[model samples]
Structures are given as C-alpha cells and as structure tokens.
Target: MNDQHIVKSYDRDLEAIQATILKMGGLVEDAILLGSEALTARDIEAAERVRKGDKAIDALEEQINEEVARTIALRAPVSRDLRILLSVLRLAASLERIGDYAKNMAKRVTVLADTRGIEGADASLRRMAREVQGMLRDTLDAFVRRDAELAREVLARDESVDQMYNALFREILTFMLEDPRTITPAMHLHFIAKNLERMGDLVTNMAEQVIYFVTGEKPQEDRPKGDRTAYMGAP
Candidate 1:
C-alpha cells in the first residue's frame, strides 16, 4: 500500500510538470502570432507588449527546470521516467529560445515602422510566422499525445517553413537591389524572416525530442532542410 501511494504521488508530480509545459507552449504560440501581427500592423504598443510578455515565458521555463530537478532528486526516476524528465528540460529550453526569437522579432518592429514599407513584405512575413506557429502547435500536441507519428509529421512540415523563408529572402533581396532607399527596411524584414526560420528549426528540434522519448531512439532518417539562403550568399 505504501509503495502504491508513492507511485501515485510520483505520477501526480509528473502530471504537474507536463501541465506547466503545456502552459509555456501556449505562451510561446501567442508570442509568435503577436510578434508577427505587431510587425504587420506597425503597432509599436503591441510589439512592446509582446516583448514584455517574454518575461512570463522565461519564468515558466525556469519553473519547469526547478520542478524537474526536484522530481528527479526525490523520485530517482530511471529508464523511461528519467527520459521523460530529461526531454522536458530540452523542450523547455527550445521553447525559451523560441520565445527569445519572438521577442527579437518584436524588437525590430519599431525600427521598421519608420522605414519605407516594402510592398507585401510584412504580409509575407506574417504568413511565414503563422506556418511556424502551426508547426509548433502540432509539435506540442504530438508531445502531449506521445504520438511519434505525429511528431514525425511535424518534422516533415519544417521543410515547408524553410521554403517560405527562402522565398521571402529572395523577394526582400530583389527589393533591396531595386531601391537603395528601401534597403534599411528590407534588411530588418530579412532579419525577422530569419528569426522565423530559426524558430521553425527549433520546433523541429522539439519534435525530434518527442520522437526520441516515444521511440527510445532518434529518427533514423535525416531531417530535410529546404532553406537555401546560405548557399545563395545571403547575409
């Protein structure tokens, strides 16, 4: 009876940690959307709000780490249980980095606000951000469901996000080359696009972590990357 009670307590503790992860994921999703929206709308106030909201995301990550540490110390979890806790740490770290990228996107909105607007650039960026946000949402779902297939699906979708970034990079470059006056804003837009692309990569990493925990091994296949900006000599 005592052993059963102890097992129940450990399960409750794990549940609480998972709940915190879900909460953090929700905040990250919001940050990605709001950051892109703020850029598109030229809403400095909204951008500031996104920036300030990152503190909460950061706090949740720290909370998760502490909770995981405490659970590990007290439970001495081994095997699958230990893997779950370690994966939680990796997931939290990835989410925190994504939040920082969102914040970086927000930080540039004000700078671009004053620069001459490039035609359709902001709208394109918003679409890219939305794609990344969707991937993140599904990745979180896969994590919660412990669905390795769903996680693999998320991995496959990352290539689309990279393609979007590649298209945006070319478009922004064309604008910069055509009009010297538009160069400043176009650079800022490129940076934001890069941030979104990086976020996609981070989401892919999280999905791989999910697959690792679920399957007891990383995916056997190499991840497909569609971003070609590096080869194109893009800054």
Candidate 2:
C-alpha cells in the first residue's frame, strides 16, 4: 500500500512538471510568432510587444524554480528523479535563452523597419521565417509529447534552416556589395538572419536534451566534436 501511494505521488509530481513545461512551451511559441511578425511586418510595436512578453517567460522560469525547490523540500527525490528534474531545469533555461534570441530578432526588426520602411518581408525572408518557425513549433511539440523520434526529426531538419539562412545571407550580401545605399538595411537583415540561425541552434540543443531525457546517454558522435556554437544556445 505504501509503495503504491509513493508511486502515485511521484506520478502526480511528474505530471505537474510536465504541465509547467507545457506552459513555458506556449510562451516560447508565442515569442517566435511575435518575433517573426515584427520582422516580417516591420512593426516596431510588435517588436516591443515581444520584448515585453519575455518578462512573462522570466516569470515562468522563476515559478518553476520555486516549485521545484519546494518539491525537493517536501519529498526526497531519488537520483533518477533528481536527474529528470535537473534536466528539466536546464532545458527550461535553454528555452528562456531562445526567447531572448527572439527578442534580439525583434530589436533587429525595429532597426531595419525604421531604416527600410515598413512594407513587409520580401518573399525570400517570409519563406525563411516560415521554415524556421515550423521547426520551432515542431521541436516544442516533440518535447511536450515526449516523442524522442520527433525530437530527432527536429535535429535532422536543422540543416534546412541553415541553408535558408545562408541563401538569404548571400542575397543580402549582394545588396550590400552592389550599392552603398543598401548597407544599413542589409546589416539589419544580416543580424536578423544570424539571430534566426542561432535560434535554430537553440532548438537543436533542446532536441539533444530531449534525447538525454529519454535515453539517459548522449548520442554517438557522428558530427565533429568541440563545436561550441552547436551547444551555446542561451545565456
């Protein structure tokens, strides 16, 4: 009876943690959508809104921190449970960092829109944003669903975002090289692309973390090692 009760208690705690993670996931999705809108629409106000939304993400992190601390105080979490909770803490921090990158994208939006005038994103940029946003959405969904295969799928698709960013970078590079008139706006676009690339890298981190959560071990090294950019997703 005691064992059954303990198991039920642990299960309930896990569910609570999952719920908190999903709430944070929603915040990240909104940040991505709002950031993309700000850039595409050249809406400084939208950018500011994303910036404000980051505060809510911060608050969520704090809430999780407090809750986890309380859980620790009330119950003696075993090593495995400790790992799960700690992994979650790290994962949530990465997501929060991703939120900041989105805000950085928003700032770039304000700068570029002010310089270039708010018409809308070019066809190419819109396509890029759509691709990246899709990846972001899928990665978050995989986490919520605890689908390791889906997380790996997110990892495989990162090259798509990279290719899109490179292609767009080249396009803007030509703009910068051919005409000095394009320098300011082109730089703005360059930073935004860089930010998106960084954001994709962030998703990759979350995917790797998901893999750890499921397997309790790191994936085999197929790619080259010591790639700091691969792991440096957040503050």
Candidate 3:
C-alpha cells in the first residue's frame, strides 16, 4: 500500500510538470501572435505586451527545472520516468528560446513603428509568423497526444518557413538597393525575418524532441534545409 501511494504521488507530480509545460507553450504562442501583429500593425502597446509576457515564460522555465530536479532527487524515478523528466526540461528550454525570439521581434517592432513602412514587407513577415505559430501549436498537440506522425508533419513544415524567409530576404534587399530612404526600415525587416526563421528552427527542435520521446531514437536523417540565402550572398 505504501508503494502504491508513492507511485500515485509521483504520477501526480509528473502531471503537474506536463501541465506547466503546456501553459508555458500557450504563452509563447500568444507572444508570437502578438509580436507579429504589433510588427505589422505598428502597435507599440501590443509590442510592449509581448516583451512583458516573456518574463512569465522565463519564470515558468525556472520553476520547471526546480520541479524536475526535486522529483528526481525524492522519487528516484526509473529510466522511463527519467526520460520524461529530461524531455520536459528540454522542451521547456526550447519554449523559452522561442519566447525570447518573440520578445526580440517585438522589440524590433518598436523601431519599425517609427520608420516609414516598407511596401508589403510587414504582411509577408506576419504570414511567416503565422506559419511558425501553426507549427508550434501542432507540435505541442503532438506531444500531448504522443502522435509521432503529427510531429513529423510539423518537422516537414519548417522547410516552408525557410523558403518564406529567403524570399523576404531578397525582397528587403531589393528595396534597400532601390531607395536610400528605405535602407533603415529594410534592415530592420531583414532582422525580423531572420528572427522568425530561427524560431522555426527551434520549433523543429521541439518536434524532434517529441519524436525522440516517443520512439527512443532521434530522426536519423537531417531534413533538407531550404535556407540558402547565406550561401548565395544574401543580406
């Protein structure tokens, strides 16, 4: 009876950890949405909100780390439970990175708000952000459902994000070259596009973690990277 009670308590603690991860993920998603909207709409207030939201995400990651460590020390979970706790730590870390990227994008929005608008650049960036946000949502759902196939789908979508970034990079570069006045805003747009691309990579890392958690093996093959702007001398 004592052993059974201990097992139940451990299970409850694990559930709490998972719940906390989900909550953090939700906040990160909101940050992405709000950050992108602020960029496109020139809403400084919304951008500020995204910046502030990152603190909660950071606090949650710290809490998750502490909880996982305490569980490991007290419960001495077996290999399976240990894998889960380790995955939880990795997932929270990746989520924190995504949140940080979103905050950075929001900060850029403040700069862009003062500059003259680039034609169609803001819309293109918002679209890219939406695609990334969808991937994050699906990736988290896959984690919750333990659906390896769904995770794989999320992995596949990263290529689309890369393509979008590359196209936007070229567009912004053309604008910078065409009009001297557009150079400042164009550079900020380039940075925002790069930020979104990195966020997509982080989301792919999360999907890979989901696959690892489910199958006990990392994806043996690297998905082809579509981000070729750097190699082609894109700026």
lDDT of each residue in 42-146, candidate 2, tens digit only:
788988999999999888888788777777666678877777777778778877888888888787876676575312335556665667667767766776677
**lDDT for predicted candidate 3 compared with the true structure:** 0.91
Rank list by TM-score:
1, 3, 2
Q: How well does each candidate superpose onto the true structure, as a TM-score?
A: 0.96, 0.85, 0.95
RMSD of 3: 1.4
lDDT of each residue in 1-235, candidate 1, tens digit only = 5988878988999999999999999999999999999999989999999999999999999999999999999989999999999999999999999999999999998998898899988888988899999999999999989999998898888888888889889998888888899999998999999999999999999999999999998655665667788888643
Local lDDT at 155 for model 1: 83
If both were scored by TM-score, which would come out higher, candidate 2 or candidate 3?
3
Report every candidate's CA lDDT: 0.92, 0.74, 0.91
CA error at residue 62 for candidate 3, angstroms:
0.6
* Candidate 1: clashing pairs of residues: none
Please provide, for model 3 over 156-213, each residue's C-alpha lDDT reduced to its tens digit, 9 standing for 90 to 100.
8999999999989888888888888999989888898999999999999999999998
Backbone clash count, each prediction separately: 0, 0, 0
